[model samples]
Target: MGLKAVLSKWFAAWANRELEQIRHNAVQLQQATFRQLIQQAANTAFGHDHAFTQIKIYEDFKQRVPVRDYEDLRPYIDRVTHGEANVLWPGKPAYLAKTSGTTSGVKYIPISKESMPEHIKAARNALLSYIHETGKADFVDGQMIFLQGSPILNEKAGIATGRLSGIVAHHVPAYLQKNRLPSYDVNCIEDWEQKVDAIVEETYQADMRLISGIPPWCQMYFDRLSVKAGGKKIQDIFPNFKLFVYGGVNYEPYRTRIEESIGFAIDTIETYPASEGFIAFQDTQQDKSLLLLVNSGIFYEFIPAEEYFNEHPTRLSLAEVELNKNYALILNTNAGLWGYSIGDTIKFTSVNPYKIVVTGRIKHYISAFGEHVIGEEVEQSLMGVARQQGVDVVEFTVAPQVNPPHGGLPYHEWFIEFGKAPSDIDAFSQQVDQALQQKNIYYTDLITGNILRPLVVRSMKPDSFINMMRAKGKLGGQNKVPRLSNDRKLADALADYVI
Candidate 1:
């Protein structure tokens, strides 16, 4: 092993010890985190308004603060954006993470100085944990790339403001700066296609090993690389490439295509990161579930997913969460977001170590005919059937076709872009429909009662979804198509690209 690899192994060993302590003390750590966050932000305007001084327990917090999404929190966020101090957290925020929201348009999430390190730490620890477990640290010596947004930041009320990934780019630890690829100039390119082209040119011949990004964009980079290298597989171009780090969307749907592009399977690390805080990361190769960061600067609450839309849903603290039940995740972070819902649903796979798997998005589901099918179900159904049929799917999305133009009963419409088409598309579609029905009983009831037909599969031309995203100006850099939608907005838009 090289000197850097040896040093990395030592660091990983130390980091894993700390992580082991956190895992063992998960409940106590969360309780302490909750108390600390409350104490730290007690003097902020939000805290004062919520009567933080009087709050003594989790119940007290539950009674004082109502669960809120970005819209409900906008008034306070607006004040902060305009240079108000102590609106959310104590003093001014260190940075504002600008992200796109469906209903709220653009949202500016605070990243306080106290909470910023948690993001960096969580990301770093995820890698270190991998090295500790797998004893693979040689990747540290080769070129690493994180296909992400521009690093350029614009000042908003004297605070740095930019996409979360862009903001994170500015904080890459100095030690890795020499090994990071796609130079800053290429990273700053605004247009995604131009940026990918530039990245391809810069790293095509380099010793890439650890490549990280959302799966779709990473696939794009790999595709561009293959073409530039005259159809050579990614592994052929960069023999040292070992690990794939991905988040934002489930990697299963893209896994087959990604591995095919690389000409071999690679180890991967999954993470659960959001603008609010770094929530969790995969801690072991044996179990794919991510370990919730209990010691991080965030206190978590969960509302049963079924009860999320109720007038008053039951909220459970970390200790109260049960394994296998879906919960709408809520956050009370040191960054000053209180009783905030980021709209993602997760299910715990293991309670001992507090490991979880992201189930779906609360808002992103197909329920036109009373069958609430979520992102996880759709991904599971399609990917399961695809594997059975030996098919390769590049991308896909599901939406309810409430009113079919041909006048059939309402049904779910699947828009799929295939890398390798199934030999019998009809049979493949039927199998996927059956798989979904098995996963969602309500969908089965609807289909059996004739209220809705089996899902209709619409094969999309190659690059169709990519073109749609490009048209909407959401191409690349953490952007991903929603897996399921209740409305036909996306379904109708995808019509133009159907083969």
Candidate 2:
């Protein structure tokens, strides 16, 4: 290692100590009474700014603020439009993290100096939690590989305007920065497509051990790593990569493929991440639920899905949520995000407080033709089908298409990809149709007889689906094949585009 690398290592050591202190304090506070915790958080926020000091002001304005989303905070973003301090925050923004969702067109999320430490702490805690769960604290002292974006710092010196990822890159620690990776400065990013390509290239050559990021990106990294190692197994490249930490989006779709690609059935932990902050991380070994970061200097609330989508929506605190129930997440973070609904749906896996699993994006549900379909339902159904068929599935996506029903307008359709397409496509389709009917009774009622023939299943090789994603310029990074579609437009479009 060079002098800079040595310094980076030293900095990491010191950072680890600081992280331990924070974790210790956080756990102590987390164990405190709920009311006490809330008061502490309120006090902390108050100390952080005068705006928060006036409890009466916040109380009076809290309910009146109207639960907000990214779009609702557009004006706040406009205040810090050029990294300059305005109504949003007190100081100039270091950089912006660009994030995309159904409604928000590439949102430029600001990361301030005060909030920067929290983001860094969240990233560190994700690793720490993985280590604690896997008993791999000592393992972290070894060569670690992070399959994340390039650590390249952008030359431009202002908050990025549109991209959440870019803005996040700007706030990363400058001392621990790597010269070989891509810049984190979103302001300097002009050609995003080229940047993604560059990221893939460097990831292909880097010596990595500790892997991170979304499962889709990890699949792409494994592909590149496989090629670079001359098809050598993952255990050979990074035998020390005993732990895999992933978040951002769902991992169920690519679970088996990743285990196969990495050539090891290692300890894997999932995280709930966003441009705003790290929401939760898997605290247990089982891949069922996540432990919400209750002590992470943020206040959380949940809005019942029924009420959130209806005329009157009421917010519930962590104390009000129930086990095995789904709700929309509303957050109030030190990052200046208040009453922000991130459009994610989550369920408490256990009755114990602070543990939940992100089920799906609220808008990602499919209710076309009156068939209410959820992501978990579709995933479970796919798992059930795979079990019944006795075949291992690497990856799959469900796209709803429509063709004319006899002579009038068409009914809904299904498109699926399987590891081994059954010998009889027609029979397999029938089984899938039955599975859908069994999963959702509404679909059963719609198709009285052989009304809508068996849903279509398109079998492809292991990487074929990922390749299709790549062809769409989404390969080798954080993007994944969209799981559920509302209409046939995407399915119809995929027919010609995907092989």
Candidate 3:
């Protein structure tokens, strides 16, 4: 093994030991984090407004701070953006992570100096943990690529502003700098398709091993690479490619097609990262659940998903969270976000060391008939049937079809793009609908009670979703088609491409 690989193994061992300590003392660490965040931000404007100085415990904090989304916190964020000192966190934020919001247009989430290191560290520790468990560090010596937004930053109110991925691109650790690709110039291309082409040209012949990105975009890159290699599988183009790291969306939906593109199965790591904080990462190959970052500079709260829309929902801290129940995740972080709801929902797989799986988004669900079907349920249902039928799904989305043109009964509409269409598509659709009904009892009641009919599947043509996203100018960089929507906004747009 090379010197770099040897050092990686040693570092992984040391990091794993520290991680074990953190795992053992997860609750205490979170308690300490809560105290420190409150103490340090006590002088900030929000702190004063929320009575932070008088707060002594989690109960006090909870009573003083109500759960807030971006709109709720925008007034304070506006002040910070206008160069006000000590508005959110102490002094000014180091960077503002600009992201697209559904209702709020654009959001500038602060990445404080104190909280930024944890983001970088958590990602590193994920890889180190993998190395420690698998003892596979040779990939560290080969080319690594993280398909992401441009590293270029534009100044917003004198603070660097860009996508969270772009800001992180600027902080690539020195040791891995030499092994990272495609060239910085190529990464700066404004268009994603052009950037992928550039990336393919630059790294197709290199010893590329570790490939990282959101799954859909990774699929795009693989498609381009295959075409460029005259239809060679990704593993043939870069035999050294082993580890597949992904986040931002569930991988199960894309796993079959992605593995097929690579021409074989490979080890994969799933991470749960957002502009707010690095929440969790897969620590073990045995369990797909992500180990929640309890010791990280963030305090977590959970409101049961079903109660999220209630007038006053019950909020519970990490210690109070239970297993197998979906919760709308809330955050209080060193970045000065207090009781911030980032819109994602998660379910704990294990509470001992606090491992969780991203269930879906709080806002991204279908309930047209009062039968709420979440992202996890839809994904699990569709993928389960797809596995049974030996079908490969390229992409899919679900939305309620409240009005039928022929005045037929209302039903859920599923737009699916398949790599290999099932011979009997009607039978396939029936299986998927039945799977969803089994997963959600409310949906079953609606179907049997004549309130709704079985779901209709619209098999889409090749590149249908890709064309839709491109037409909407959201082709890449953390933008994803919502798995399910309560309304027909996405379904209407997708109607143009249905086969």
lDDT of 3 by residue, 1-499 (tens): 7899999999999999889977788899899999999999999999999999999999999889999999999999999999898988999999999999989998999999988999999999999999999999999999999999989999988999999999999889999999999889998998999999999999989999999999999999999999999999999999999999999999999999999999998999999889999999999999999999987899999999999999899999889988999999999999989999999999998878888999999999999888999999999999999999899999999999898988989999999999999999999989999999999999999999999999999999999999999999999899999999998889889999999
Per-model CA lDDT versus the true structure: 0.93, 0.60, 0.94
State candidate 1's TM-score.
0.99
Q: What root-mean-square deviation over C-alphas does model 3 reach?
A: 0.7
Cα-based TM-score, every candidate: 0.99, 0.77, 0.99
Where does candidate 1 stray beyond 4 Å? none
Best by lDDT: 3
Candidate 2 lDDT tens digits, 238-350: 66567777877677656766777778677777877776767877756865587677666566778887577765687776666788777989876555666678778899876
Query: In model 3, which runs have C-alpha deviations exceeding 4 angstroms?
Result: none
How many residue pairs in model 3 have overlapping backbones? Answer: 0
Residue 394 of model 2 has an lDDT of: 63
